[model samples]
Target: MDNKVPYSLPGMTESFLFHESQLIEVGLNNAQPEEVPPPAFVPPCISIDVSHLFTTDQIFPTRDDLINWVHGIAIENGYVVLITKSDSGGNGSRKAYVMLGCEKHGKYVPYRDPDLVEGTRTQKTECPFRLKGRPMKNGIDRDWRLKVMEGTHNHEPARSLIGHNFVGRLNSEEKEQVEKMSKSWVPPRKMLLTLKENNPLNLTTISQIYGACKRLRKSLRGSLTEMQHLLKKLDGDKYVHFERHEPGSEVIRDVFWAHPNAIKLFNTFPYVVIMDCTYKTNKYKIPLLEIVGLTSTDKTYSIAFCYIVNEGTDDYVWALECMKSLLADQAMLPKVIVTDRDLALLSAAKQSLPNTSHLLCLWHINKCVLAKCKLYVGTDDFAELVMGKWGEVVDAATVEEFEVQWMQLFNMCKDKYSNFTSYCSTTWLVHKEKFAKAWTNHVMHFGTTTSNRAEGAHASLKKMLRDCKGDLATSWDASHSLTCNQHTEILASFERSIHRIDHIFMFPFYTNIRGFVSNKCLQLIDDEHIRMKSYGGCDCLLRETHGLPCGCELAGHRSTTLLSINSICY
Candidate 1:
């Protein structure tokens, strides 16, 4: 045996250790031959030993023990086995359980039925299994089934309890009681023809009706609270009532509140309020406060109005207070207030609206000039000449130029009015700062620089009140109607004329011019001078036309020559 080979059994062969180098060589040509040995063979051997790390009872004596063991195994090896008891025979007894394999530590945990935990598996029964589906739906279905079963089984008893409680507790018959109450209650009248009449209820009418109602209530010994309650009910139902005695203020407030369109109209432009007063025949002068909005359309619209006391010694304070009330009510403070140069009015406006700029109407200035310059009427013709030819004077760039042109024209007056020139100049020219920067420019174009809007409004009110002939209440009604009607018509006309310059052109321009002339010349000049030069030519005509001097320069010209020549030529 070779040392390299291990010992073998008796059936082994020598060829097992044979190498190719040691193989017997046989040559066909030679007579000698060598045979190779067969490989060795060894018998298979087996060994058997039985020992347990833990007994079956120690590892899994109960189902919980088995489950815990399996859970441990599953955690370690990612696999598990389930053992369940089964019945071996027809007798109801536990037996050797069946073992089932499942994925260990899978995404889902298996749930076992408590009733079947210690019982044997049955072949005929459906196995409990959880599928991959919505857990909420499964829970809801189980609860609904339980509720349905309970509802069906207990329906009669629940209904009996409810009916007993409802009927046994009430003593009165509900339907009969309701019918009796309905028979006793009376329905109120649905309409009030006299109270709801179409005629508008103004302040005076409301006061009268309220007084009558009060008298009726007192005489009849009626409940005042009940009457008030009824009136309140009427107000609630949108029916007319006479409780609000002062309807004028209420109407004005409503008109302003109901239509913010008017406010929007004012806010659309730079606005200046022009206010004034006129005497109504009722022995009371009514101060009319107008909110005038200067539109981009180059037109002024009266957006709001109020009647204050007239601006006079007795009523100026009251009027101003009323104006302040109006402004406060409207929540408006204007940038500029343009009005006639009434001292009381100015003081009131200045004190109330401290931040606002006050402007004296240029129209008033012309009137003042005329009143102060009476003697200048015949000699200098300053008022008449300047009225027509002072476009350059108004357009003068500086105060110096204005004064120079003013004096040049003033000095040309006759000797009689020399003192008048000084007086007029001292009064009107002394206080140029009170007027607006645009005053002269505005007068140059529009002529009468006072807001004719106020005058027009006054005229309109007078016309409407004329029919009432100074009856205060009637006049108030008429004035109110006039304002509303005129504002409506004027706003409509303005809208219509906005695009129609032809219609605008049809309005008389000379009216404004004549107003300016009258305010400036006739009002300021004295009677004697006016009479002296009534038929005579104008005195201050520096620029002549057609040999006959202009009106002012030709005042003292014994122009019978020119008058006769013209007559003769004709």
Candidate 2:
């Protein structure tokens, strides 16, 4: 280092001496540097075009101006603007844009678009007034439109009007208006206060109404009690003893009154009157008489009954007299009268209605046969044979035929039976065909040929009376009521029959014809034991065993046909 500085010291000594001498005169001044005045505070210069800021229709001018104006306003507010076409319309036109500000780069970059300023005034004006009025009118209009669209006025006004009417009366003007609008109106002249407010009875309204009602009810109850007392007093005085009359007098009157009604009822039908007598357990030995009639429509038998209390040497005569009284009217005479071949009843019928036919029920005839032929008619076949021939013997052309057939039938059975030839010829033989016809038609229809209607009726009556413990009067009343009920039932059955006939019989003949054919077929099928031939008449199996066709098959067939015909005819 010492060697390197010798030349520089010689060369620089002179220069340094010159500079050092010049720098010796310069003085140091320690003064603060004047603060550079803050650069003039320039407010951010914002240029807003505000042209095309809104839609064409929505803006006061063209769409471009509205859009640009909106874009410029966005830029001034520190935003960047970017223009792009809206995809909704699929048009290339820039329908919408975004604004980006110059402050994005930390500088107040004011946009200088001369084209926007020049074109702002020339844009079309769509509706300047609408655009200006939108903010203020939109809220009010939207609320009003919602109410209108919802039809809120229709219901609310109606409810409010109804509520007003319920509250109180309207003023004079309002009342007059309502009257003018209504078809009928009458207003009260005086305004009445509510019952609760008026307190008319000086009590709570509910208590007052209740008390008034109670008082009214008490008065009504008192009136009813007085009326009842008066009625009781009257009834007590009016009560009469029904026991004062002699029993015989009452019986006479009842018999007289019942006779006419019985006669009337009997005359209405082609009825067979059946009579029977039973002895009651009494000192008087009351002869219970029952009159039965066969319904021509249904063939069902019914009974009307009464009793006579008399016992003496002439008891049969008294009974006959009572029967005669019961059948006093000629119209009451039944077409056929059936009895047990009682001499007394036969004599009474001969006396009362000489024209009326009297038949010994085949039942009585058979009983007589059995009693007489105890030695001969031993077997049921012989008994049935005898009973079967009874009708034919009665209908014989001459007495000799009947005698011949009777003797033959008797002799054939004599080996194992009693000889009943004479008995069959005499007592059982009624020469009158009409009388025999009655036995054949009515009695024989039921197996065994018995008029069990009267016997059955008597048994029922006795049971009913017995159940009452032999209280004569109670039994009599109960029997009377029972008889009435029976009559009512019979009447109902008759009415129903009438209705069925009327309703069913009015159909076409072919329908009825078919029904008749069907019934015949059914009968043929049901009566399988009955043998039929093309030429010879059919022989009912029942005839050989029961002495008759048993009439069941015949009756069923006939009833079915009749009912069918009735239905069709009606």
Candidate 3:
């Protein structure tokens, strides 16, 4: 036991160990930890057509000009290619093209035994992909161009694509989440945050996430050649029309689409339809005009959707003509078409469907009021006063009453506020009949004073076409998804009508009108019944405005019967 000497040094006798004990303390105090080198940059194995990266300049414009060009292309395409090796000329220009490789590719790793394993990992660098370029002289200066592209990976290239870093490439799981989030209308930035929380492996840069989302979206929206193929894949129940601006090029300027339900709904409720344009719905920022109708039950139904290159009168006229052709029965003209205050749309509607009453939306008139007053006082007390007064004046029940009130309101406004009065007189008053409840009392507006149905449809479509970026094919994909959901909702309503009525008063009239009209109409009729009980006296305003029987009509002899009560406006 005494043979063992306790000392930091090994295999020394006791006397030798005692002599070195003082030196051992000094050596331990002077010892330092070994240094570690930083990890080397590795380029990703990415494939791109390198033709755009080349240049024929004699002198590399600047010292880093060539590097910047190649870097820009790689960054834009997503994935990083680090400058691994570089060569230089005497004049500080690139003599020959530099070499770069993916971070996961090339280089030798040190070997470690599993039994004696320390905290170290070896990344397999089998990918052989490389990008090559160099500067050349043309007697005057050095010119730089992409010389060669070499190598390929056994596996796929990258995910988070088109960025300055490798973090832009997405893996399989991240790609799935991206597509799901995109379909749900989650913005790309928001998707990145969500992906980071669930999957901490790949997501790093915004470009990476954007690239992943775009890849799936690009798949959803195929090439232009697939567009013609898409059109041919349609069922016979769909009505699709294509219009070209230039006959020689056959470039489509406008397109109109209508499903069988749309056409059928138009046939049933052709009295009042709304056409509102949704903008920035695709790459061209053209207007996506949604045409919708309201049933007797107040249920909104799709009629048609039109895409026009511009919001001009000619464009509107052509779209309307196409709509008429789709319906195929010019005699079945709509009683009115509610639209925002677009002079071009109104002009086109008048020209194309002269018989159809073109009504301006009251909501649009209200907006104009705000616009006028804001121009006058921004958002002060005067703006509120003018807005309030305008609402009252336009909502007047009778034409005679409205005229008198408008004069009083006008005189008061003119006497106190000249510019606001001028705006109303020169702009809104000239189109009084289009918006005033008095003039449009008998019009079958379905209780709507605006193109809210179209706006609502736009909002719904935006949910499908979230952020609204992409091309023609992408827009069509969004429309198809929304249309399918709409059909499902319509079917559910139909099923409910056939089986049972919920939370609605049941009169014999409900039984009579169940199969004929919508449940919305029956509910309205029930509401009218409740209102009828409270009526001391009545005017036929509800009948005129809503195309339904009023208390006054019900008070008459033939009450509560669909046919005898009051003929529907359509």
Would you list the C-alpha lDDT of every candidate in the order shown? 0.39, 0.41, 0.68
Question: For candidate 3, what is the lDDT?
Answer: 0.68
Instruction: Tell me each candidate's TM-score.
Output: 0.36, 0.39, 0.65
Model with the higher lDDT, candidate 1 or 2? 2
Per-residue lDDT tens digits for candidate 1, residues 1-570, read: 444345656877876654434443324233456567557333233221111211132323343444455434423432222333322223423232324223211232223765653545221111221111111122121111000001011001122222222111222342233233222321111111233242222112333333343343344335534334434333443322122123456321111110134445544432355666566534344444544544322345555544444345434444434434433234555555667867777777777667666666776776666655544464354556655433444445456777777666665654555666576556655656555332333221222246576777667666654432332333333444554564575466445433333322233422222222212122222222344466654432212101222345324543222231111011
Off by over 4 Å in 1: 1-270, 281-294, 298-300, 303-332, 371-376, 379-395, 409-416, 435-448, 490-570
lDDT of 3 by residue, 280-388 (tens): 8887787888888876556677777777777899888888887777665678787888998899999999999887777888877787788877887568776676677
RMSD vs true structure, all candidates: 38.6, 43.0, 20.5
Best by lDDT: 3
- Candidate 3 wrongly placed segments (more than 4 Å): 1-209, 217-239, 377-385, 507-511, 514-516, 556-559, 565-570
Please state the error at residue 67 of candidate 3 in Å: 32
lDDT of 2 by residue, 155-189 (tens): 11112211121122233444333333221211111
Q: How many clashes does the backbone of model 2 have? A: 36
